[model samples]
Target: MPTRPNYNQSSANHPIINTNNNNNLNQISIMNTNVDITSYVGKVLNINQHQVIVEDVLGQGGFAFVFLVRSSNQQRYALKRMYVNNERDLT
Candidate 1:
């Protein structure tokens, strides 16, 4: 009888798992704070080393929200935040 190859040691396992790990590495860095309507206004959000001052909510749909944000230099931008609680949401 022939033995089945051990998939655990397969070279193919590295890339897929590493890619998922890299993605999760960025994702798990996000704040896990319970963000609500009250928590947004007057709050400062830091993204990619840029400091964004949350001014007001631009819009919202489902679990995603777009807020009006301004940089320290007065540049304006729309910041979109998604609420994800588990693996299903991440997928």
Candidate 2:
């Protein structure tokens, strides 16, 4: 059997309560630790004055890499990192 990376499971302590409102905040993100966030593992990313701890990598594409990040408030979000910045887009 392959060894698994140890991740903090504190996020699993909270109980999930789904409300009538359609919001992602009500969902629970039970990370499949089997898949690791290779490059960004154990790293905190600060972008646009916002800081988040990368938990698991959601997915990756040609131009950008999506990460499953957790905020200080215990909220989770899909942080999309756009790598291909063209001169026109930056301008």
Superposed model 1: Cα runs more than 4 Å off: 1-35, 85-91
Rate residue 70 of model 1 by lDDT.
70
Q: List candidate 2 segments past 4 Å from native.
A: 1-37
Q: Residue 34 CA error for candidate 1 (Å)?
A: 8.2
List the pairs of residues colliding in candidate 2: none
lDDT of 1 by residue, 14-68 (tens): 1111123324335323465544554676787656556777676655667766666
Provide the lDDT at 35 for model 1: 48
So what's the TM-score on candidate 2? 0.53
**Each model's C-alpha lDDT?**
0.54, 0.50
Give the worst 10-residue stretch by lDDT in candidate 2.
Answer: 17-26
Q: How many pairs collide in each candidate, listed in order?
A: 0, 0
Per-candidate TM-scores read 0.54, 0.53
